[model samples]
Target: MNKWLQVSFVILTFALSGQAYTDDSKVSLPDDSIYHLDSEWVTQDEQTINIQSLSGKQQMVSLIYTHCMHTCPTIVATMQNIEKKLPQDVLDNTEFVLVSLTPASDTAKVLKDFAEKRKLNQDRWTLLTGDPQDIRSLAMALNIRYKKSDDNEVAHSNVFTLLDEQGRIVFQEVGDINKVDETVARIVSQ
Candidate 1:
């Protein structure tokens, strides 16, 4: 067969294969990427998505609960501080992810209310809740520890982690979130 006919046959075969050949090349995630987790998460907007869906941009993440009245608030404030300190371009590409430590109670509706109450702009922020096990798995991956009390209060560590586009932790603050804005800014700027 002629070269032109051979190329046409291959193209038609791929077209008939549907979405399989739509992409030119498949991008592989790193071994350490959290995006590899096969867990379903529900966003405040009520959309179901996997961690892999958040893979394309840098992420600033913290684990907090809607009912927390102590260090959680301070941790969120520190996250906001870092968010505000980043350059406009960096901020544009960076997303702030707040994962619920109490998924059993932090449903989509509760998360929405918390977001609205705190004036978290949906464009730059995402609030997520998932199965209890999925939440725990993610928390473990981030090295965030949490335990529920008799009063339904969760005592968790204060952690602010920066994840690069590949979903690998770039920078993390375990207990102290003070005076780390500059470091977070510098890392996410690239």
Candidate 2:
């Protein structure tokens, strides 16, 4: 009975951890179902950018406000971690975009200051804040929901969408601070 109990314990452990060599495949997003960036966006840097602008580059899109005290910081940290983990080729071909949903609050100066404060590479990163209506429309199209809370706070989704060179969302991840490296790697491989 003791030997049988040991065997069961081992089986349970494997089941709980998922078999290490079970030939299980990772579930990837379909090419056709991805949400594509279709419209032109005005950047916080006073530049107009279109979806086709990223035709040859992979992009990671996330919704964040510079004023956010909690999750937004985590999102920024996660993005930095992903940037750090990418290979040189991936880093060269990829761009990180942060679209501010709080357009009424985060202005160009604010975004510029925030980017500088974070020491983000301006060439590889874009933090955008523009027309509130446009931001809302884009957020809805991307399926990124956000609502303003009390006193300059917001309750928002912590999702990051990785888009391919053709502007197709290849992967979606939530709570990126912990899984950012894996998410970036998965998208980079495709």
Query: Residues 121-141, candidate 1, lDDT per residue (tens digit)?
Result: 799899999998988889888
Off by over 4 Å in 2: 1-38
Q: Candidate 1, which segments miss by more than 4 Å at Cα? A: 1-27, 174-177, 188-190
Give a tens-digit lDDT track for model 2, residues 1-190. Answer: 6999999898889888976444211123234423243456656587877645655677888889988887888888888888998889878999989988787788777888888999989899998876767777767766888888667777888887777766676777885577976776686677
Candidate 2 lDDT for residue 139: 73
Candidate 2's displacement at residue 43, Å, is 2.3
Clashing pairs for predicted structure model 2, backbone only: none
Candidate 1 residue 124 Cα shift, in angstroms, is 1.2
Which lDDT value does model 2 have at 40?
A: 68
Give every collision pair in model 1.
Answer: none
**lDDT score, residue 64, model 2?**
92
Question: How many pairs in model 1 have backbone atoms within 3 A of each other, for residues 3 or more apart or on separate chains, i.e. clashes?
Answer: 0
